[model samples]
Target: MERAEMKMKVLSTVTVERTDDFYKVVDQLNRTLKDKGLTFGFALDEKDSNKITMTIYEV
Candidate 1:
């Protein structure tokens, strides 16, 4: 489905220290969501240096 067509349902917001590459984090999140049969609504990253606060939602 198109991104704009997605319907978001807030799930969880979390903060984590950067332990891996940004792209790797994204890929892992995609894989995890797919495994759970969940659509990835979107993610908001409040990035500050090495710390990232990520808000994850379901579609």
Candidate 2:
């Protein structure tokens, strides 16, 4: 029998009124993902806005 492969993807967004808040949010997210045995990918921008986005993919 052949083993099946699975993929998981997660997206998170944070909007902050201050620059420090942005870094803090990202740091928390990284820790969360590390605890979950997940890896971080790249973020995508939708149009042009002040929102920060992140993407994660794992198998």
The candidate that achieves the highest lDDT relative to the unseen native structure: 1
Top-scoring candidate (TM-score): 1
Candidate 2 stretches with Cα past 4 Å from truth are: 1-20, 40-46
Residue 16 error, candidate 2, Å: 9.1
Q: What's the lDDT of the predicted structure labeled candidate 2?
A: 0.52
Candidate 1: the clashing residue pairs are none
Query: CA shift at 27, candidate 2, in angstroms?
Result: 1.0
Error of 2 at 25 (Å): 1.4
Q: Enumerate residue pairs that collide in model 2.
A: none
- Over the stretch 18-56, how does candidate 2's per-residue lDDT look in tens digits? 343665655675678776756554333465455445555
Off by over 4 Å in 1: 20-22, 35-47
